[model samples]
Target: GESVGLHLPTLSVQEGDNSIINCAYSNSASDYFIWYKQESGKGPQFIIDIRSNMDKRQGQRVTVLLNKTVKHLSLQIAATQPGDSAVYFCAEKKGSNYKLTFGKGTLLTVNP
Candidate 1:
């Protein structure tokens, strides 16, 4: 995630509650999206993905949704725990290109 003087968005939730993080992408042609979770002092870890052809996909305790019509993407975390506290990014890839444009992530804090 790259930010030009822009602060990342933040979301706070109680442990055991659900968390929803949202991202808006500029490229409508982006056909693939992947979400990554990054903890402090660690690299971003792949969490989930959703293709433009599909509206939703679920993995483990996370769900990803793509709204191509609005160029919007969302990640839903079920039963958020302290381990889930991290910066989550949504990156999009277009066509056959493996390169992705990442959004400035949202910082999720799970309060116990």
Candidate 2:
């Protein structure tokens, strides 16, 4: 069977440094990508998102980049903090479908 999506399982970064998390999606038909962060005992929170029409999108301290050609997506966080430590995941939406396919999460630890 073909893989639908892929993501790193873990990431560690020093406080005050930048963090970059990578993901690869196999569904070329997907048109929307979203990044989410989940803290311990809590639900995932939306971080940032990028549409297929755009290559990059930025939030307050987060940025999302999408490369359709390579079926890759990346999330960049500036000045990582201890509070930023969490599991991050990417979800993809194909066309107008209401359901989203979630990738394997990456647990990020920010060392203080």
Candidate 3:
């Protein structure tokens, strides 16, 4: 089976800084997209989503940009902090059931 993984399993940053998590996927036919923030020992929470028809979307303190041409996606967090430290994942809806294929994971380290 194919798998999605992050280039960096862990990322470190200082408080009040910006963080960027990158994801690379193999399935180019995937359609819908979503970014999730997961704290230690917790389930992932939806950050933002984008459809194949669009290229970018933004949310409070967060932004998601999809580049279908290259099969790449990224999540940008503004003013990252201790609370923002967590693992981030990028998922795509690849089937009729809207099944999500999640990237391995990225741990964000925010230094306060």
Q: Which candidate's TM-score is highest? A: 2
TM-score of each: 0.91, 0.95, 0.92
* Candidate 1 residue lDDT tens string, 1-112: 3321113499999999999998888777788989999999999999998888999999999999887787778899999999999999888888998888787889999999
Clashing pairs in 1: none
Which candidate number has the best lDDT?
Answer: 2
Looking at model 3, report the run of 10 residues with the lowest lDDT sum.
92-101
Q: Please give the clash total of every predicted structure, in order.
A: 0, 0, 0
> Pairs clashing in candidate 3?
none
Candidate 1's clash total is: 0
Model 2 off-target regions past 4 Å? 1-4
lDDT of each: 0.86, 0.89, 0.86
After superposition, which runs of candidate 1 have C-alpha atoms over 4 Å from their true positions?
A: 1-8
Evaluation by TM-score, superior candidate among 1 and 3 = 3
lDDT ranking from best candidate downward: 2, 3, 1
The deviation in Å at residue 40 for candidate 1 is: 0.4
Model 2 pairs whose backbones collide: none
